[model samples]
Target: MVKKIASIFGTNMAEPKGETAADRAYRILRSAILSGRLPTDRKVTEAGLAEMLDLSRTPVRNAVGRLLIEGLLQRRKGSGLWCILPTRDEIRTIFDIRARLESYAAARAAEFATPLQRAELVASAARMALLVDEMLSDPHADVVPRIDAENALFHCKIVEAAHARRLELLLQSTIDVNLVTLTLQAYGTEQRMRSASHHHEIAVAIAGGMVELAGKAMEVHILSAASFVLTDPQADHPAPRQGKMPVRPG
Candidate 1:
């Protein structure tokens, strides 16, 4: 069972300390789905999932229920559970909402971000730029995962800086995790650098308390990403998960 999930996710499963069995199951399955390891057409069963996770059906069942509630999984009348596959229009609509919501967040962040929060946002952008350079320099470097993580961090910092609980919740529900991974995977070298530059500009605007500029930068960043994904056929297909970037030996 462990071997099966490892093969599917391309990494060994780790049970974190103090995590309940159900939480562990949920985290693993959620990662699998959001990381594009589980395709929409893949057949999934409670029994199969339980076997793969090396857990009893109870925890896996509980996890499945949660995923369904979160709209990560949908139950069919007779077809069983399937990963949610948003249509092109659905994705476009999602991005539309994301642009507005995140723009407001960035604007508010410009007005209210603490010194530390601003610093963190700028630092995150710098890190993403470094990651982009590494990927460009090394043809074999697996930098997608790192870039994705850094990108999420940069956005999250902006949200945190905004300090509006309700807005944060709205953004959380609006952003599709699965779509994020696919978009990053589809990005070419040019697009990746463009994205990194946008991040830097947004961060600088927020840090300098340029509220309107921050908002505009965020909106343009999001709309450009949408344009890239909408025009690229590759964005519609989920690629195999990339491993974490390997650390260079000193």
Candidate 2:
């Protein structure tokens, strides 16, 4: 079935200068995925998407192929192309990779972090601890969202402190999957406190220029959080559709 593009812009609008049809399709599709408008497991067909965007299949195919290569899209036999539906092992693997990259970032943070960056790391941890404290004092304080926001700030400051833009770029998608799509909802008060304590240790190690300790602290922080997610039956994740070829056990 053909779908015409919406009249967000009046008819007879031409493609922007210096942008190809594929480029235009790609930006729109990526925005949909990133914004959760096209949630995980939602199917996409070349013809359908091409028609929806008022583009040709050749360009739509090109755009989808690129997203597929980036791990944002996956293909199943019956399901065709769909948003990512990660399995348990896939989630674990993502964390493993994050742990490694973050370890390196933390170590570098210790060695190369500026005084201002170290101060920010400490502040980030302190702020996150305050959120945990608030949640504990009033269970219905409506602070989980605050904690999630601080969680991103806490880790991001560490990575950004290292002055490694390339590393940050590499970890952006994994971080988004955790911070944006998934969350720390699986953690209880005790777990939140433990994770908070680790952040403090990380901040201190970085402040004191303890390279190995800083790195280990970061590793522990991530793995500990990942443990909660893996064990939580209700953890937010993209579930694999049944009847597809099963992913091998890890």
Candidate 3:
């Protein structure tokens, strides 16, 4: 039996720009994975992807390699490449790392961030707030993805302002993992929007030169979000016991 293949583009195709084939392939595949088009736990083959993108095997292989290193894709011992799906324990560990790193970054950003950096952070936060408002007004809006993207940008800017490349890269990796979990757990909810607003508060505190306040706010924000995702109604629950087991008498 033949598997159904999705069309590369249902619309007109513009002329290709001067970008490298590998770069194009990377962007296309990354976009698909991030946007949920190539969903979690889905198997991806080099030949299938090459056919879909109208490219040869080499570029697709390079793109897949980069994605695998970025933790967006994984290769099994006997199976092919599959989209990375973090276990519950992995999710908890990533969130714990993010909470510590982001809080420290927020504090350092408050202390050493330049005026221009502060202004940019403030502007990003304001833009994020407006996006949140838009999402709240129309739950079915197409801006949901954009909102998530911009929210990520806002946090990224804060981390960059801290001027810690090591921390930034670590946070970025963990964030990519967290985003998959967030997308799975947080589809549409007013509470999620409110949680985003709290992120804005962290930005405001940092911009105001309140280092301790910024750190505390960021810590609370990350922990709360992690907890929400872990315990949300849509999240996986424990399975029921199969049979009665012998119990020791007290």
lDDT (0 to 1) per candidate: 0.78, 0.70, 0.66
- Please write out the lDDT profile of model 2 over residues 1-250, one tens digit for every residue: 0011111101112335688889888867764664455656456787877877778989989999988876778888977787763557877787788789889999999999999999998998899899899988999999876776666666767777788777766765444352223435345789889978998999999999899999999999888877877886744453322333221111
Each candidate's clash count? 0, 0, 0
* Top lDDT hit: 1
Off by over 4 Å in 1: 1-17, 34-36, 234-250
Question: What are the candidates' C-alpha RMSDs?
Answer: 8.1, 10.6, 11.7
lDDT assessment of candidate 3: 0.66
TM-score of every candidate relative to the true structure: 0.82, 0.65, 0.74
Residue 109, model 3, lDDT: 93
lDDT for model 1, on a 0 to 1 scale? 0.78
Q: How many clashing residue pairs are found in candidate 2? A: 0
Worst 10 contiguous positions by lDDT, candidate 1: 3-12
Clashing pairs in 2: none
